[model samples]
Every structure is written in C-alpha cells, then in structure tokens.
Target chain A: MPTQANSSEPPELGLSGRKIIYDEDGKPCRSCNTLLDFKFVTGKLTGAEGTKPLSAQAPAECLEKLGTGTVTSAAIGESSSKAYPKEDPPDVNQLGRASWTLLHSVAAKYPNSPSDTQKQEMKQFMTIFSHVYPCGWCAKDFEKFIKHNSPKVDSKEDLGRWICTAHNEVNEKLGKEKFDCDLWKKRWVDGWD
Target chain B: MPTQANSSEPPELGLSGRKIIYDEDGKPCRSCNTLLDFKFVTGKLTGAEGTKPLSAQAPAECLEKLGTGTVTSAAIGESSSKAYPKEDPPDVNQLGRASWTLLHSVAAKYPNSPSDTQKQEMKQFMTIFSHVYPCGWCAKDFEKFIKHNSPKVDSKEDLGRWICTAHNEVNEKLGKEKFDCDLWKKRWVDGWD
Candidate 1:
C-alpha cells in the first residue's frame, strides 16, 4: 500500500526509533539560519514503541535541527561467530574485534575518519550508548550527542528552544571549518598520531 | 546552564528530546509549508562520543528521512511498581496480579494507548523487532520502523526523506486521537467500554 507522502521509505533492515540533536547555542535547528516552529509524521513498523518498522516525516526546519544520518550497523552478521552481549561490558575480546570489524565496515563504506576529538567523542559515546542503544561503537558518537545535549525539560516549547540554540552553534562550526575524516580514521584504527 | 531558548510559554512538563506532531494532510512541517525546511540536531552525552557536545543545523530540505523524538521519562512520581506494559496481551504479567500492576503502571504513565489496529500490529512488530532491538516492547516498535522504512537510502539526503514520510505516520496514530489522562486512568483502574 502507498503510505502517506510524509511516511518513511520503508527499511530493508526493519528498524525504527527517534533521537534529539542540539546545536552549540543549544537550539534545535541552529545549524540552519532559522528554527522550526512545530512538525510531525507517521508510518508502519516491525517493532514496538521505541523500536519498530515505520515511515514518517516532520517539518524541514525541525529535521535540520536534528542532524539525522545513518551509520553502519555494529551487529556482527550471523556468519560471524561472535555474540553481542545485551548487557554492559559485552565480552571484551568480542567487542574489540567487533570494533575492528566495524572500523573496516566504516572505512569501506562512509570511510570518513572523524577528528581526534570526534574519534574520542565517538568512543565515549559508544561505551555509554551500548547500554542504551544497539549498534555498539559504530553509532557511539551520535548517541553521546543525544545524552549530553538533550534537556530534561518537560515542556515541548522549552525543549524546542534549547534544541535551536545548540543546533546553531554546531552548524556554525561545521559551516566554518573543514574536518579530516581519513586522518582521524588512521589514528582510531592503527593508533597513529 | 542556560542550554537553549524558550520561544513560547513553559510547558508543565518542559518537553525535551525529539518530538513529532502532524498536520491535517498528515505531513510534517516542510511538506505543509514549503517556505520552511526541516532541521537537524546532534549532541554528545556526558559519558559518550566526541569530546564535549556537538550539534548542527541541517538544511530545511530533507537530507535523511528518519524519525526521532524527545525521551519522556514522565514517571509522574508514581511508584515503579505501578508501571505497565504498553502492549495489550501484556508481557511481564506472569504473576497475574503483578502483571495487572504493570498494566496499571502503563495505563497511568503511557502517553497514549494503542488503537484496535495498532494493538494487533504491535504484536507482529514485537517478534521481528526482538531480533534487532533489545528487550522491551518499546525497543521492538522502534526497530520495526527503522527496518520497514530506512532501506536503500545510502546518503543523509535520502534518509531524511524516508524518516519524514514514514515515522511521522506511525507516531501520529500510536496514541489515541484525543489524549485524556483522566479518562485513561479510569479505564485502567476499571475496565473501559
């Protein structure tokens, strides 16, 4: 069936969830010149509340603030013998090897090595995010952004404002500078300075 | 610190995280109003990812179609014991009364209830989502959405378009049409018609 125009495109992997992003000024869409007032979208899925298969959309202004993107899945394919632990401190060897594998996965795919700071930040995000989100280290950095920047605000209005300011700062930096992803990757993989 | 701004009056709950609200066409912000665009936001939590926090504002246009929202830990001071499963058949109810207690907990706190069709769809999503997402029905739902919608889109641009279209639709219908906390509480305590 044809879903709504705003629905998701339908996932091949069957996943669904949401995240919040903030800019340097702590706003939702600060990266762009403007901010969003309000928005919404919906669709079907293969899972429940926080997890499912779905299609959805929101205001373009709102999407800009969130900085949404896709990172490689950290789950080892079934062909691999490693078992990913659901709890904290997954088997260290398994995780390390998985990280190594993920490095290749990233390199072969996006191949963008984040800055030293970005790499370190990604590592921090991975360690904490594994406990809360799937994909292990592959998506650690993005998850970290969610935890630190997201406000404890209960009001949508306040939350929106916070998102807007932070979003602005972050976007401003990206617009102003150029990042070297390949160099960062070498440091992360071979421990190169 | 003063993380973000508050464009409007403070909400009782002070909302934060990614949130979605739909319009009459069931489209997100930009589709409804072309002059505007979607925004993107990113951040790093205290214990995760890149040093400090980083966020950005994206183009109002769709970069990756995905769904996201603010995390609401609205326990509302109710005892943890009062929490209930958001599902209908209801897992975690092995102990009968204990299960009932969980249902009651959910009834009081769950932002919305599953409609007749959604209740059925959730069951299907849970099974598939379990493979990708961790424990809990919420995670299952989120996983299903990601899998069903975000596929074949290799770039941020495509992903944004996917999320905006799919996630928005499902979220719109998850909770009942009109959310009434008092009414739901009555239904939870005493079976509703």
Candidate 2:
C-alpha cells in the first residue's frame, strides 16, 4: 500500500532515482534494465506533510515498463542556506494539489533556475496544476501574476504573495466568501507543482 | 493522406469545423464544428499542432477502439479564399515559429491575452519555440524591450515600431545580418506583441 504521511504538514522535498533490481552480485545496470534519474532539484518537504509526487512521476506501471535497474535518493538543498533554517516549521500549504500549483508558480518565478532540471520541475508543476485546476480563468490570473513577478522572483515567498493576490481575486469574482489560501498552499505542496 | 494546399503561398487560416458536416438526416449542427466549438473546447485537442487530428475527425478505426461514433464532412469554403487579400502583408521576421515566440513575448510582457484560446495557443507556441530555439537569452532581451516600451505603448503603430526595434536588436545579436524589416512586416500577422 502507498504510504500516507500526514496530508497536512509540509514535508521534506527531494528527488529520487529508481532502485536497481540487481542480480545477486549487485552489479551495475543489467542488460534489460535502464537507470532513470528522478531528481527533485527543489521541493518543500515537511515530515508532517507527505511528499506529493510531481506529475512527471509516471504511474508505477509505466515506470516498471521502463525497467529501471536500481533506485537511489538524494535530499534537495533549501534554496538559500541563510534564508531558511535547517528545520523550519512545517508549512501546511506545501502539502496538497494546490501547493503543487503554488510550487510551480514559485519555481517559474525563480529568477535564476539555470539548470535543465529546474526547468523540467517547473514544467512538471505546470502540467499537474493544469489537471487539478482546469479553468482558463484561473490560468489567466496565474499567468498574469507570473509574468509580472517572474523577473523579480526567486523563492516561495514571491509565489505565496502572487497566489494570495490571485486566489483572492478569483474567489471574489466567483462570489465565494470562503477562500482557502492555506488550504491551497498545502494542496500545492502535497500534490505536485 | 493529408491534403496539401498552396505550398509556396500562405494558405487561409480557417478552422475546418466552419463547414457543415451533414448528419444521416442531412441536418447541420446550428453551431459550426470548426476546431474551436468541437475538439478544442472539449480539451481533445490539448496538445495538437499542425496536422494533429481533432477528435471529431479522428479515424473511425481509431475511434472505434475507444467506442466512439462516426462523422461526415464536406469542404464548404472555396479554396481560393484561403489566402488573405493584400492588406499589407506581415513582416518577414514575423513569420513561422520565430514570430510566434515574439508574439508570446508580447503577450507574456503584456500578459492580457484576448481570450482563453489565445492563452492556450500562446502557451503551445512557447513550448514549441523553447524546444526548437535557444530562446532564453532572446526572451530576456524581449522582456527588457517590453519593460521599456510597455509604458509608452498606446496604439498598434506604437507596437509595430517597438517590435521593429526589438526584432532588429535580437537579429543583430543573433548575427542575422541580412534581416529585412520589410520581410518581418509581411509576416507580422503571425503575431508580434
């Protein structure tokens, strides 16, 4: 059964590679196996919150079909060592589908994501966000926020502010008095973004 | 086999669903089936590009496996009307994929697409452009230009002149020494800001 960590707490975010199903000797990649690297260049993970899979994480069946040889894990570094402490309090927002969208918005707004891996993560977040919130109006609002803040952005704080503004506006237009920024923040993290 | 229209001349950009597709009783849908009202709105054409089949037009064999219905078609519009009458052709630099990137740069800069369709199309164009071109540096330059010009932009003519300046700077940096503004003017319809 899949593990279910607290779906509410911010969890530690990291990238993982497939575990090589090796022969008895544990040699390198077998002839029929290919090792794929699933790197989470940046993510928010709190033990209280479960690690939501990025949309890029194919179904287990698909991964099995790819026939990965082995799996390895690595911890993603917090973007700025001085900016965030080693063990910041768990962020409730980084726990669900909403948080995933938030993460993507955050990553996209990051000013200096120079590596291909960062770009890939951002793309994955966008794809997953599309599936959960399939509204054009929402997308328009998000895009507007990103376009304005992307050049000047580089962290989750920037995205949080954008989301705060966008979500409020969207909810207001929908005439829904109950807008859940924190709920969405958790969903964004718990889901994928 | 895919139908080939004029290879040298720009064909008319019209949706196929604009024509009537008669039912067994010979009744036409009051609404046109063109790509928009049919597959696009339903999300069937999400990742489609040139030659990508719309759901309504998918092959019977393909649809049958998925348990679908049949569709009939007749070319309604005159083929001669495909090309636009000479109304100042768009600039050359504004043709094809490159021009599309420029359009998105404008949209991304202004970030208020006319419609959801425009947003979706712009996103698709950006995806394709990113894959085909080393556009990061160029995008930065475009962004810079937009930042400066957006404040003064008031009319289409202003936009055109701004595009002319940005395109020249970009082409110059990319070593496109022979780049002609007249050519870009002709293809400007492709999308420039």
- Identify the candidate with maximal lDDT: 2
The number of residue pairs in model 1 that clash at the backbone is 153
Candidate 1 local lDDT, B31-117, one digit each (tens)? 111111112111111232112222324321121121111211122222234332221111111112222222232222212333444
lDDT of 1 by residue, A1-193 (tens): 1222243342222111232233243432111111111011222111232232234344432333332212111342222243321111121122222333322222221113334543343333233333322222323543555567653233323333333333344335434232233233222222221
Query: On residues A1-193, what C-alpha lDDT tens digit does candidate 2 reach at each position?
Result: 2223234432233222233222233322122122221112212223422254423355643443332222221233333222211221111111122333323334332433344554454444444343222223344555665556442233454445455555565446534343344443332222211
CAPRI quality of model 1: incorrect
How far is B109's C-alpha from truth in model 2 (Å)?
Answer: 12
Q: What C-alpha lDDT do the candidate models reach, one value each?
A: 0.27, 0.33
User: Which 10 consecutive positions of candidate 1 chain B have the poorest summed lDDT?
Assistant: B87-96
Cα displacement (Å) at residue A21, model 1: 16
Worst 10 residues of 1 chain A by lDDT: A30-39
TM-score of chain A of each: 0.19, 0.26
After the best TM-score superposition of candidate 1, give how far the Cα of residue A65 lies from its true spot, in angstroms. 18
